[model samples]
Target: MKCIERIKYPEFDFKEYKASEGRHSVHDYPAMLHYLLVNHLIKNYSSENSLIYDPFCGSGVSIVESLKLNRKAFGTDINPLALLIADVRASNFETDRIRDVLDRFNIEWNNLTPDIPEVKNISYWFKDYVIKDLGKIRTFLRTVKDNEIFKFLLVVFSQTVRDVSNNRKGEFKRYRLSEEKLKQFTPNVRKTFISLVEKYLKIVETDIIPFTDFKLFLQDVRVSIPIKNVDLIITSPPYGDSKTTVAYGQFSSFSFDWLKGLNPYGDGDLKLDSLCLGGKKIKEQKELPSGHLYDALKNIEKIDEKRALEVYSFFYDYYLSIKQVVKTLNDNANVCFVVGNRTVKGIRIEMDFITAEFFESFGLTLENIFVREIANKRMPLKNSPSNITGKTSNTMLNEYIVIMRN
Candidate 1:
């Protein structure tokens, strides 16, 4: 690795520092950026121990940032992988168990081997020897008595899977490497995992506070969220359905495939991406809370009614999720969303305008809509919005913040 400093971000006036100690760039939305929002907008109730909630807490950046500021952080998501990361990232470490684990693993590294679980085309995703090593690490991790250490270790393992897998890097969707590339490539899974474990452990030791109040759970925002009297509801939610938006499910499924067996959960958790906003099917909805979306759908209806219906369904689900967020918040509390409006069939859907109007319908006054150029993008710059070839554009160049009051 090389050391560099003073990188430039176009127009986002946020700080340039990092958040989590480990390489926790699972999804972008830096801590300093979030802290800036929390500091600037949330003036009414900025208590040190204020209850902060993020309903659609993808990767738990908001929740983690809240904890860092000595606030009570809580978040809910459908994906167990996200919960695991959030729990590990937000929680401060206690004992030197990680050191002990690392010491013992140094001696047992060669002897240990992976007990690979059953997955579709596992050979294609990972090499045979890599599988063996991963299985061994899994076996060793099972023997670990401490649950807290185990969770952080899972982050290391998850990163290892992503790093060593045949799936092309950077792209959220999993696509196996070409036969020539696969043949030529060789990865030292054990070394990489061990290095990451050390890095994460150091982060826990030096960065995290002794104790930070946080609760991360696997729950759909459209259904239920166990938070109340929330001081601030800040989140950068899923843009739309994961299929054409961002392949968060596909990005997480590889790691989750290995992790799900460690605990007892069904295939429902595996469908986290599909369970995202607008994941389900529905008819074209004209009965919209916001006229902006309805009009956009009308324009889209002329082009492709099927895709138009998809937008309606997504907003319908989004509307419900926003309602759930409102129910859990205290009176006069604020809800802010850092959302990117992706184009469908090359039509720019104004999520910021739509969200502000929808929130107004819920009796929440629209505070302001702040626009910022996306400096650190987690997703690819170019993509097919309609999931059809030749219908592509620059997706996340700019992001909008829709702030509303309860």
Candidate 2:
């Protein structure tokens, strides 16, 4: 089947796609679109036993979809929190064992005292009581024996932190909630944890797949995969520099705080460009005809002369790393990358085209580009217009899925 022919599901609709049932339904991203894309790739280019891979498997959407369709799946991400999530979501757990562990955790969690003695960033976003309750749940998970069950519960707890905290209903900027709003819905931490766990258990029971093989990696995608040549690749690489697009680490810092051993601010983690206001190096870099972004010290009137050179050097080096991975693909194998364009310094950076150009150097031909609208993704703050580019729409309505073949 041709790519377009395979994707032509009679039931597909953008509004209904947003409301479709599955993991992506609760979170952001169109699950139907991903499902359609995955199905198309598998049917046209992959066998049932083909090794499917997602380099930026955020929350393991592709991995889960692959298993649901009975394919071998592998995924990688730089965020430890994301890695943990991907691990649990894609794992084929024994239902009975998962239920037993969750029940035990709940029992022990209730008996423990809600006292988080050493807090980090808790005071800034959560009330004292909420923090105490959250700490108690974390304390119990620390003692759980089954690593799979423990990690699954950890994601559930982490997911709830945003809702129970002072920042539940605010726009996707930083965690800035009013005191009155915080008091309105002071979610009992223990109660919320139990509810989330129950929901997860119910989902697992209903949707668990018993015979799928999956692996999760906490590493940058620019490196080589430990496995031999893969049969297929489907991923959405980070848009622009990590610093400028979104502060994924900062967004999920609260959960990382609870997962004590995990490092949210580790060295290899990408530093956000929004927070960098003014430094010398931001001025000197050459602006790509296609508005590729770079991390520079914020608040400079123009790009810093010295810093621009350094930032460009860093970007090219990263691109070379991605190039190495592309070169490792099996002959005639197919790769699909979900990416989008962005504006930098009031210029449109056609990332899709630039990425096509990059991959072509490795003998991969651009087959097709499909545009999907991501209307639900978090947008820029209303009051804060982008300093470099003045446009202020928050929704990422325009997206591109670039297909390539060796």
Candidate 3:
């Protein structure tokens, strides 16, 4: 087989890592870009000690690959669960230690009575017995003094909640089971939780954390970042509002609410789905320098004004976020935004073109745009162009890798 560093563009295929499962399933990123683009950006800096930062790290692919290369990685996300999953992914622990924690919990499992945590409309999301078992998991987790152990157990518990909740599997937004479907559905929460815990343990044994240090922050990139002078950035920003493009908030809500229910702000309390790029409104008086985004918005407005507003709002805040991230980069440092151009009301929103314009306005130079077919990404497969309710339309199948430099 050819050596990894020697593999070049067009020749490399995602089939090599088709087994991108397990913890990888915790969030979505183009598996190919995570491997290829990350390596490509690392090649920019000659020093092995260079810092790699991802503001919108999502599931932490950028950080993980940076560590694999023995580089110090720093990442932050507005979503706490994303940070938690990234923390679990980057966790440095021996298999024996994890197994011991679980074994100890199992021994004390009989003594602890199931106690449910408070959640908003708890009954609407879970069955009573499922709630009891979730409480059992939370109670046991609270007893573990080790932070690493606590985080790993939390991942298992969060996954368990998603699997057993009334929400349909794979749907981002919370949707209750139909009355007929509810009549027949039954999930054994305790058994499912234990099985998932064991499954994650096996994955832990095989994972190797080669890097020595990493810093993960729970903050919004649109507001502030804790670190500065980042050498490189590799991130996949949201395509549009969470409501239309991707329901990141919806996808993560079940797990987030459970974490919040256990403790108001200890785990998660942000309305992430609604707090993202297009989540809130921002006024934009100046016209975009490029005509593409402007034209698309006008067309969308003629047909669907609500969607037009969502797109406008997303770009307005997204522009500010890009401005903030650029300030943290060193002179001549490279930034790669792996993004998709999704359609709304049959008009394509050219994120690549728009991103390049934003970078230019900030006195940065556009390097190159690499187009690649997205591979090994799990999406709902179809989404409506004009509906926030999610209608059937052709989903995003390709992505643009827009690389820019200061």
Candidate 4:
């Protein structure tokens, strides 16, 4: 079947789309859809050595898919933990060496002493025994000589922290944990770490590992990078302010606080306060719109101007950063961004429209827009509310795949 016929507008049957054979399906996102899009670009628009890029490469999905197709890949993220995961997933490593490191990690785990000062927040979330066990594992990880293996182990440990924490598995926001429940399933940090390492090892052994050049950086998309001429760019920027739809910072705080040295109040270059929003004063700066649509939304008057400005400014900064990165691409390069609209004060701000305006400002032509239904596997029924006025409304239910070209 033709590709265009396969991608029917409004009602693409994504359930029937199976991922490429032998591709590990552990990561989130529609792998088959992303594979089809990446494959299409490679077959029609790319040369053998074309450089593919994903600025907001969550879990390294686009870069991993690109590598499987023999394309050089570049990815960056503000989250250090994310960078570590991407680096391990994208790099070539010897299985035996990985196992050796795991063995050493186990030995070190057994002999480790919890001498390091305990983080106050860590103590607050985890029981005394749980905190001590986690601290021992983290301390051992710090002493590992193999940086790649250390990072992989870190990912394993980080992923397990959520499961072991008092936080509910399905809910991504902060929640108080009952002492009884915390005592029941306090994750054995070492045991979970070993199991996760083995699982990752099995995935690496079974899946196809295509030979392609790849790089991962703990850098923000808003800044310039070393790559001069990218051929294709694929990314999904953060959904406006972190507090709105997806609390990425809060969701990943366990790892971020331990590894990235993030301040509990978010006092870093990548903090939520640093983003550009339309209504709120962020970093002491007045609310400013990056485009007309945002300005129009700000003029609604019914919406809290301060809050709306903060949200708009955050998104605007992220959009502008992505635009700057796109500018570094080759003249013939194509860029695809996955984003969704968010509502404030019952007014839906068309994020896709705002993104289109930003891209147009960079002389890029809009190629296509694909709308996908919101299937949040993690937070399936947690926040079904369409409005956030009382935290009882389901605010967002759809996303847009905005495709453009230089």
Best by lDDT: 3
Least accurate 10 contiguous residues by lDDT in model 1: 1-10
Report the alpha-carbon TM-score of model 2 versus the true structure: 0.79
lDDT of each: 0.71, 0.59, 0.72, 0.61
Model 2 Cα lDDT, one tens digit per residue, 96-163: 78678767776676588664644456677787778878777767766767767766777777777766
Over 4 Å off, model 2: 1-13, 25-33, 114-117, 170-173, 262-318, 379-395
TM-score order, best first, reads: 1, 3, 4, 2
Candidate 2: Cα lDDT at 329:
73
Taking all chains together, each candidate's TM-score versus the true structure is 0.88, 0.79, 0.88, 0.81
> Per-residue lDDT for 324-355 in model 4, tens only?
78667999798877776665565666677667
Of the candidates numbered 2 and 3, which has the greater lDDT value?
A: 3
- Name the runs in model 3 displaced over 4 angstroms: 1-16, 22-37, 40-47, 178-184, 261-266, 381-393
Q: List model 1 lDDT by residue over 1-406, tens digit each.
A: 0111222333344536333224244322211234445445444435677888888776676776676677888888777777777777776666387888888887887787567788778887889888888888888888777888787787788888888899766546677777888888799988988888877777767766534788877788889777889978888777777777765677777787787666322233347667888888785355868877977888888999898888888899999988788889888887878777777777778888888877777788876667766444445433464354223245566777777778
| Per-prediction backbone clash count | 5, 16, 2, 25
Q: For model 2, what is the error of residue 382's alpha carbon versus the real structure, in angstroms, after optimal superposition?
A: 11
